[model samples]
Target chain A: MIALSINWHAEDQAWLLVAQNRRGLPFGIGGSQLVAGGALLALSAPMAGRVASWAAVNPHDPTPLLRPPAWDDAVVAAAILGAALLLALLSRWTERLGLRTMLEMRSEEGREPLVGPVSVTLGPDRATIRGATWEASYDAALLTGIEEPPGYLILRFGAARPVMLPRRDLTEPDAAAVRDWAAGVLGHDDAAP
Target chain B: MNEVSSGTPPRRPWERPVTPPSARPAGLWTSPAPDRGPVLVVRVDTEDEVAASRLAVAAMTPRGGLGSAALGGLVMLTAVTAVLASGSGWKSPVPEGLPLLAILAAIAAFAGLGWLAGAYLLPLVRRWASVAHARRVLRPGPDGVPPDGGGPARVVLGTRALHWTGPRAARRFDVALLRGLVEDRDHMMLRFGLVSVVVLPRRDLAPEQQEAVRDWVRRHAREGRA
Candidate 1:
């Protein structure tokens, strides 16, 4: 099992996570923007579709007799494409807005941290986040289907937003513990850290 | 350890007393017992649903709040467009006066409206309705059993199966086959095949009752809890 401790690096404006699992994969995360950007990128396709459909059904002139069907289809296609681009832009803007909201919520005159250090303890089929206002214990089974990207570990607990942990933040011991923990959840017989 | 904080506090009156074989009481807690055996029942009432629903929605979305944020932005844009279209002559910028922009704006406006309704309005109404139903169901009526309508909507965790009963529908699944458990501060979700049951933390219960349920869930719901 890997053992690690993490501290909020205020000067760098990032979380300084140290793990001890040399065999664990290295990824980068810790900032809210990283997760927010990734999530928005994932939803871009569906958002585009929705935007396009909306543009098609909404007519500036309520009287449909004013426009030809062929012209409407073309307009709709353009609208869909345009909506997607606009939404992509809007997603970034909102992400910034959300980050700002989170920071403001935590800052004391933009100085004191609202969220304290978070301690994670991983055991057999269980993981617990302690010393945070939103402290919780989860059944690690919920993460069975999570796909680990090359460097990132996505820890999802049902109904809560998944927390993306960058493997880069972990040390060899931490990585080993994580790999062992993930192996159990993922049901793999041969995962070495 | 500090002497002030070292020892446990005295137990409260409402709390179930711990006893040996000679001091055991006939009924320590009065919660309904599942067929398998007596387990702490977390009876979910109507209050605190908006917050709970938010947790459920967060789980269903791919990236957590991205979906909601996008929808919210779209709603704001459409609302502005709707207002502009109504006042000034808002026309489509596209060729042939297809009214493309107006149509798009209208669509955005309506979709945004619908999202808001589903996210907020519908849940509020359901919460109100459930509270109303529970009132009548728990009322001192002729029969002690719940009114002819199904029992107050609850997620019952039995030793073998997990059951959910609403006013009109009921569902149960073997606990052993449950796929996963996801929980945040506001809600706990149990997933089966494709469906999920969202169980909210009961705030209305006495402190002891709530603790009992939490202890029970920590043991039964989480894997490898002995």
Candidate 2:
């Protein structure tokens, strides 16, 4: 089996920032809807008066008399506001579920980085990583994906924190070997030449 | 000495030398400074500010399903309310002229709310305002010097911190405190904390300098842990 070992870190900050931003999304949506609904409710009466005066001035016109129902207007506004609130709640619940999954995966303390460098061994079909106090192995099929962002190669597993391998510390051959192994396992065509 | 022993284990592929070949060398504008170590000075212009403004707007914009749905719902409801109030005639408890006043009020309210929510007008206004501000603040005087007695608008990357000095603004942030680095096709945003961010145009830096910046962050992160 083709295997390689390297020091790696967890991209904790990026994960945290993303989670923080996601947490605010539902609130932003709900608040905007509330303001819009309230404004519409407040303006319903005056709008009725304007249409009435315009009809009276054009008495000779053949247009039918139009009547605005305040109660119906209020109901429509409330219904839309309620729908928005429901969507926001649904979004919040989904975010929480994702967060819970991530937290559960993170409960495996051995997967996290220790004060010293963590050792990661990447093989053809599986990988083993060990910190100061614990060790774990993950099947290649279970990994979600791999991303090459600038200076680091990130191995993602669902919503969990990604394993980041700094490219600067790897030999070109070692990096190529790891990339090829991952590409083969993940069924990707972008393996290093 | 005549003991049967297994021969030395075959060398593993990963046991090879770890040092990678050096990246291609590129020229950078650097100068010596007093206590800050080697400083890389990057000139800023209107184009850079425009890129930064675009990045800021993108960062502020919401993403994903629900956030977009909510924004869409807001717009739809606003339109529905305006149509119902203006076109339909409702029996008013008050006066006939008041309905016209209500329609005007509704329009004003929706416009204000949309701007505050950053759903429509705010981003456009912010982009325009930022570009205008950049033009005024980054404008150099006749001698190519800033009018506020500070140097021309430039971003200085130092060993310890990143410094941004313009005619109206001077800010310094420690490199070690950098929380995250987010990048797009055209720009990179260096996030210092939850609220503070420095957007830099990617075209301003050479490939080597970009790598150097990433190396600096990785080195500091390790050192901080130590």
Q: Which numbered prediction scores highest in DockQ against the true structure? A: 1
**Tens digits of lDDT, candidate 2, A1-193:** 4444554332433343334333323333223334443444344433433333444333333232255455765666566566656664565455445544544443343222222255666655556554443333455544556777677677753222255667876788867876776777767423533
* Candidate 1 lDDT score at position A68: 35
- Candidate 2 regions exceeding 4 Å error are A1-193, B1-41, B57-68, B71-125, B141-172, B182-186, B193-201, B215-226
Candidate 2 chain B minimal-lDDT segment of 10 residues: B24-33
Q: Which candidate is the best by TM-score?
A: 1
Expressed as tens digits, the lDDT of each residue in B21-124 for candidate 1 is 23212221112324342223344433333334344334433432335545555644553455455553333453564445545554555456545644564344
